[model samples]
Target chain A: MARKRPEPVQIVKQRRDAALNGLVHGVPYVQFLGIEFDRRGDELTAVMPFDEKLIGNPMLPALHGGAIAGFLETTAVIGLAWSNLWEEIESGRFDTDELALGHLPRLPKTIDFSVDYLRSGLPRDSYARARVNRSGRRYASVHVEAWQDQRGKLFAQATGHFLMPASKDD
Target chain B: MNPEKLKMAEQFISAVPHCKTLNMKLTNIGDGTAEMSLPYDLRIVGDPETGVVHGGAVSSLMDTCCGAAAMSHPSSPAGTATIDLRIDYMRAATPGQTIVTRAECYHITRSVAFVRAVAMDDDVDRPVATATGAFTVEGK
Candidate 1:
């Protein structure tokens, strides 16, 4: 009777979830803003629930442009980090935990961000997805699109440039 | 500087929910320029290990300042919405220091107003970030 090995797919999936949870929860600003992430495989969609404190111009009753920008930038950093996670995990260079708490690696640093407001953000749950245009050893660029109701009809879009954290190997 | 416009600017900051959340205060608003401040708060910190204020908080301050500047401009309409904004972060803001932002609406056209802003903490010489933006103007 030999000991059986755990299923590879299930183990990988669990590790992936743990890594992402650590990354998102590590930042205090994300918790303060009440942002959550839905991860399907390697893709991540950021969700910012509506709160009265997010309103900027009460007359228009619109979500604050700064809040929206923060959401986009956060998404970009997470997306870039997630894209790099697999390589570290596959090479067995990164260790993860189910209860990682505050033990996350440093997140990518934002160098610059540009945002275009397409429409007033409605007072509801806002959703955003980030697309990594390029990720190198030292730098990454991500584009983020945010919407309240329909994904096709974006309320805002942003391009963010980030300086990737120095990897353990480097 | 018009006193009426100055009053409007004060009312504007007091009315904003996000401004209240950030504890933002309007210091000056006149001559197409606006100044505002956000007191250091632990909740808005980005990196817990470093205790540094988030870049988002800095940008939010700048955005609101830009809007106030645009509204106070002589050629501005009753309201303005952000069209596009570009922000460059030069360094991390020191913790426990209130960050201040100043914005100037330098140009206005039939449909748009352009603005530039800088955010700094105690170190006025080294800015935390700089921003340039375009805002929509309503009436002709």
Candidate 2:
């Protein structure tokens, strides 16, 4: 079924504030975690500010294992969204908008998410980067890594599959 | 099995701020197995259009239950931390249904504990997700 293609500018904003997480602005869980993003070219990184609320083991002051997984998963979503937008712009389906990343016609759904806790996440600023390995009509795959200050030293890593709801263009 | 073991397990889970924030509660515990639950909350929705809880929330539930199970394991007496966790999603959980997870410490060596878990809503026939992981154990 053919659908209405939104204006180029509207495409970037999608339906919400695209500058932040593509679909995470109104999400209470993501908001509570205080996740932010940086998009440059094909690379997308998710940054999580260190907060007392994120601590899992107060004694060790370690970040909760689940929170780390959440961080990685959320980053992967943003990365996939950004990757799709980049492709759309390249193919002229969507215009290049430096101000905003285009919106996803439909939110991506998680098919599977796995996390490898390499080292204990300490109570400190942590960041994650996700690389989209493949994005097709039916599915997308991403490999994500979270690290403390040093990029080489990772706290955790994850691989996830997202169900990309097919669009009219597909 | 002992009261002291139960207390230890509960205390360890309660100390986690993320667990408190998510409101995951321990429902039951045996020698090397545990059950946990998180009631449906809109705050954790991944797809606002569908109101389905995010897979991350399910992952959190499994990770916590696994940790609790590791704590109760007779071998991991000192305490435990996650080493690795892998979850495969079967489907998105139904909206407004509490997600429950059950985890078991299937095996334990001197330094590590192996765990597996399943998450589901009310339907016992259809599981929402399944997980397997290993945890590091310390000496008491």
Best by lDDT: 1
The chain B TM-scores of all candidates, as shown, are 0.95, 0.93
True contacts kept of each: 0.81, 0.71
Residue A110 CA displacement from its true place in model 2, Å: 1.9
Tens digits of lDDT, candidate 2, B1-140: 56676676777777788888788888888878999999998778776667888877888889989988887886776778999999998988999999999999999999999999999999979999999999998887
After superposition, candidate 1 runs with Cα above 4 Å error = A1-9, A90-92, A98-101, B1-4
Task: Give me the displacement of residue A120 in model 2, in angstroms.
Answer: 0.8
Instruction: Score each candidate by Cα lDDT.
Output: 0.89, 0.81
Off by over 4 Å in 2: A1-22, A89-104, B1-4
CAPRI-wise, candidate 1 is high
Please give the range of 10 consecutive residues that has the lowest summed lDDT in model 1 chain A. A90-99
Q: What residue pairs clash in candidate 1, if any at all? A: none
Best by TM-score: 1
Q: Write the per-residue lDDT of candidate 1 for residues B55-79, one digit (tens) a residue.
A: 8888889999999998888888678
Q: What's the true lDDT of residue A7 in model 2?
A: 59
